[model samples]
Target: MKNISRSTALFERAKQFIPGGVNSPVRAFKAVGGNPLFIKKAKGAYLYDEDGNEYVDLINSWGPMILGHAYPAVEEAVREALSCSPSFGAPTAREVEMAELICSMIPSVEKVRMVNSGTEATMSAIRVARGFTGRDKIIKMEGCYHGHGDSFLISAGSGALTFGYPDSPGVTKGTALDTLTVPFNDLNAVELLVEKNAGQIAALILEPVVGNMGCVPPAEGYLEGLRKICSKSGIVLIFDEVMTGFRLSQGGAQQLYNVKPDLTTLGKIIGGGLPVGAYGGKREIMDSVSPAGPIYQAGTLSGNPMAMAAGLAMLKHLKDNPGIYDALNGTANFIIQGLQKQISKYRLSCSINHVGSMFTLFFTDKKVIDFASAKTSDTVLFGKYFQAMLSRGVYLAPSQYEALFLSAAIDKTIADRIIQASNESLEEITK
Candidate 1:
């Protein structure tokens, strides 16, 4: 077995200080039955753990390292920005440039606001929607995570789902009352909610292509149907594209699916793997934010120069080479196809939900189109598969509810290796 002694030691040391031995709940590997591997460094498509073991990274920093870790352009940009100073706590030319680039690329965003993380972006977006519409209630899809904001904890996904506390305790009963939820891809449910809530609902937010619930794509015409519903009901349509933005397409899932949302929250690739996020939409709606309107939201490090520089470099590269999307999707398809062959060969009860470069190998025969269906997965078997894959140098997301992201750095040879690892891992786990 690959030595994970160092990781074990680190976890032991960390638990005395950090909560649950990791900064993030999912990183504790509680669901997968092991201590987490502390990453030493990452480059291209591989992660080197503290144990001196190498892994073909399938998580890609949870969907940020699209061009792969430590990419030359992103690194160069950050280095140059670092020399100037890390933070000014004031606006800079880079932030303006970043905003212009985002507005230009994303079809719905005529104006934008930068934040430190996806949670901040989503929280701010919802507030802005409420202010603009003069309404109190909002609708979120079940299992579609919009960060750790108090209003979004009900029926949430991602780490919340993995920990078996979708409705987090800290969230007030009042917050829960305002947040309405329905299963994803169910248009009729959404319509019914809209009718019942009527003018009280301010926004309808969702992940146009959900990465939280293992990469579930929208049902055919689902986006269009929601768009129609929101427009008719005078409810703000917010697409929490924090995971799908830039990764799925130049304009994100909205552009890919040919539907536009009033507000879009973005993170991950836009920050070039750094901790940054943004929310934006139509000019009138964005004008409702502070300094222009009344709704207040501020952050000292909202547009840190380093983040802006790194994001600008990453976004510019993507804009210039649009073919990267095609390459990433192609690689993902190859890997998924190989895994499917293994499932067939072993007669494994597994199903995969894929969109663009994000996917999940669910340990279930049932199609995973919604949270309830996703839960039908055999978590115990997934834990075994995860351990098996880790042993074979293929690092997957520790939680069964999480999706695996592919990067441009993974070539055909690496893809073949991952497939081979999956085949061996499956055999070993089943035995």
Candidate 2:
């Protein structure tokens, strides 16, 4: 068995220094009720934890390590970039190169802006949209997380058609008032809300394939219908592709679904597992951002050289080797099918949703099509399953709300191991 005593000791010491003994809230394992594993290092599909136990990793750093951990190309690029400097706080040639690469790959983008996180990208895009359209209200689907921005911490109001309110404490009522919440895939609900707001609506922002509430995909023609409605009402359409960009396809969900948006926010994969975010769209709209237009947004470490080098390396490689997606999706399909077979054999109450390389297994018999349905998943069963899998050296996302990411590193051998572990874990938890 893996010796977790060292990890427990570290967590005990860390709680005195770091809040919840983790830099991120989820890392504390609050939802699963356990101390988080302290990973010493990772290579390819395996994670060597503090206790010297290795696990076949399935989370893939929340969907960034498509090429897998510590990829040689990405590592070398970061090392080369560090030889020059870290940040310039001024324009650099590399920045222009990155922007050009993104614009070239993404059909809707004529201009782009770099930011530090997904939250900044979405927040900045909304501001620009409001400024250009002269509108104050923005619509977002319920349970869709757009980072911790004050305006996005909203819940659906009492009525199915009402506006949003603060779902978390510390979010002011005024901030919540300007944000409207709607159920994903319900195009008629959005149409009615847009008709009611008319000229006051700024934009309709959503994850084209909802990952925050598990891998709930868009309904047939749902995106096309939303686009038509946005066009008719003159409301900006924003696809929060932060999770699906690059991972879904080289062109992201926009290409996968054949529905374009006015703005796209990207993160995770673009940074090559680093902290970076970007937003891009039509030149006219992007030109409205500071130095070129009225909406102001700036960052000192906007294009940190190390992050740029790593991202450029990863993007360049992926752009050149389009077959990476095929490999990743193939492995994903293999695992999904194996798990489905196991679930059927065990007669477990579960729902599995997969798209390309991202998937989620929900502990419910009903399909999780939206936030309300996603809430019905059994967390207690998931917690037991998580421990079972962890004990057997198969690492998955610690939370049910997150997606299980696949990478090129997971071969047939690793897939078999995962499948076997999952089978045993299901049996252990269900009993």
Candidate 3:
């Protein structure tokens, strides 16, 4: 067994200052039933914990470190930028360059605004949509997480087309009243809601390919259906591509699927592992934000030079070398196939959902299309599997609800190791 004395000590010390001894709730390991390991550093698909245990990272900072952790190019760029000071809180040439690159790469984004987090990007995009459409209500799919925004912390109430109820304590009924939800991949339900609400809906937003509810991909004609519905209803179509952006494809799912959104909210890979986000779309709609028009969203550190440099380096590498996507997807397939063999070998009641490098191994025999079906997974079994994998030196997402992110750094050798470890893990768990 790996020693965790330092990690345990740090956790005990951290809890006194930070809530649950971690910044993110999932990192607490309440779901997996263990004290979370304190990571000392990470580099290229590996996490070194304070306890001296090295883990093969499968989450990749929840889908950011696409090329790999501490990529040399990004590292050097950040270092050079830091020499110019950390935060200017003022416009820099890098921000303009970053904006230009994003607008050039993403088909839907004619104009863009930088923010600090995915939450800010999504919330701002919705606000822009509302402003553009002169409407108050918005529609989001069930089980899709856009972040912890007030309007996003919602759950489906009893009836179809009924306004969502606040899923958290702090969100008010008034905020929830303007937000509506229906099952993901259910086109008829969205159509029904649109018909019921009629002309009142400002936007229809979704994760084009969901990563939040365990990497659920859109059903056949699902994204196309949403685009048609929104176009017909004059509602802004916002693709919250925070997870899928850059990870799924160069232009994200929109480009891969040949569908264009009115707005796209981006984070994760865009910052090259730093805290950054962006929302962009059509010219007329984007022009409505800030000095260009009425809708107001500002940030002190929206275009920090350090973040821009890192993002630029990462994006440039991606744009210059398109083969990275194929490599990432190929590596993911290798790992998934290995896991598949183990499942068949053990005759396990499990199914895996995957899209490119993002995937989830659900401990259920049933297919997962939406949040409700995803919930059918046996959390107890998943917790067991997670612990089993962790003990074998592979680090997975703590919760079954989240997806496992594979980076480009997970090469053939690493993939083989993951496969071997998984096979042994399955044997141990089944025994």
Candidate 4:
């Protein structure tokens, strides 16, 4: 077995100080039945753990690191920005340039507001939607995670689902009541909800291409249908692209799917692995934000220079080289195809849902188009498979519910390595 002595010791010590021995619930490896590997550093497509073991990184910082960890351009940008300062807590030319770039890239975003994280972006977007529309309730998809925000905790996914608490305890009943949920890709359910709560719902928010519940893509006309429903009902349409933005394409899922949302909440690749987020959309809706209008949202480090520098470099690179998306998609297809061969060979009851570079290998044969279908996966078997993969130097997301992300750094050789590991892992787990 590979040595994980340092990681095990660190986790034991961490439990005394950190909640559940991790800053994030999923990082504790509770779902996968092993101690988490504490990463010492990552470069390219590999992670070096504190135990000095090496792993082929498949999560890519949970969707950032699209160009891979410590990319030279992003590193240089941060280094240059660090020479000036980290945070000014005031206006900077970088923020303006960032906003302009976002607006130019995302046709729907005429203006944008910077924030510190995806949660902050989603929370602020919903507030702006509510204020602009003069309504109380909002609609979210079941198992679609917006963040840790109170309203978003109801029927959330990701870490919340891994912990078996979709509706978190700390969230108030009022917040729960205001957040209506519908199954993803079910236009009929959404239509019924809109009809039943006509004029009460202010916004309808979802991931255009969901990454939370294992990379489920929208059904035919699903996005267009939702767009029509919201436009007809006068409810704001918000696309939470925290995981898909830039990683899927230069302009995000919206651009890839040919659909536009009134408001878009972006993080992950937007920050280039840094703590940053942004919410932007229609000029009229964005104008409702403070200093220009009434709805109030502020962050002291909204546009941290370090984050802005890193993000700007990353975005510019993506924008200039549009072929990155094609390369990413091709690489992902190759890996998924290889895994499928192994699954068929082993006769494992498994299915993989994929879009662009994000994918999930579910331990169920049932189609994973939504939360309910995603849950049909056998968690116990997945745990075994996960450990098997880890032992072979491949690292994946620790939960059956989370998607695995691939980076540009994963070349054909790395793809072959992952495929070989998956084959061996499947054989071992089956035995």
Measured by lDDT, the strongest candidate is 1
State in Å the error of residue 129, model 4.
0.5
Query: lDDT by residue for model 1 over 1-431, one digit each (tens)?
Result: 89999989998999999989898889989999978999999999999999899999999999989999999999999999999999999989999999999999997899999999999999999999999999999999999999999999999999999989999988999999999999999999999999898899999999999889788999998999999999999999999999999999999999999999999999998889889999999999999899999999999999999999999999999999999999999999999999999999999999888999999989999998999999899999999999999999999999999989999999999999999999999999888
- lDDT, each prediction: 0.94, 0.86, 0.89, 0.93
- Whichever of 3 and 4 has more TM-score, that candidate is 4
lDDT of 3 by residue, 1-431 (tens): 67889988999999999987998777888777889999999999899999779999999999989988999999999999999999999999999999999988997899999999999999999999999999999999888888888888875211111112328778888989999999999999999999999999999999999887788999999999999999999999999999999888999999989999999999988899999999999999999998999999999999989989999999999999999999989998888998998899999999999999999998998899997888788888888888989998999988888889999898899999999989888898899
lDDT of 2 by residue, 1-431 (tens): 56898889999999999987988666776666688998899999999888899999888888899898999999999899889887788888878899999988889888999999988999988998998899999999987878778778785311111112328678888888999989888888998999888899999999999887778899999999999999888888999999999889989999999999999999998888889999999888898999999899999999778888899999999999999888888898889999999999999889799999999999998888888887788877888888899999998877777778888899999999999999999888778
Comparing 1 and 3 on TM-score, the stronger one: 1
Which sections of candidate 3 miss by over 4 Å?
A: 156-166
The lDDT of model 2 is 0.86
| Prediction RMSDs, each to the true structure | 0.7, 3.1, 3.1, 0.7
Query: Model 4: residues >4 Å from true position, as ranges?
Result: none
For model 1, the stretches where C-alpha displacement exceeds 4 angstroms are none
Residue-by-residue lDDT tens digits, candidate 4, 130-236: 99999999999999999999999988988888889999988999989999999999999999999999999999999998888788999989999999999999999
Residue 249's lDDT within candidate 4 is 81
Candidate 4 minimal-lDDT segment of 10 residues: 244-253
Model 4, total clashes: 0
lDDT of 3: 0.89
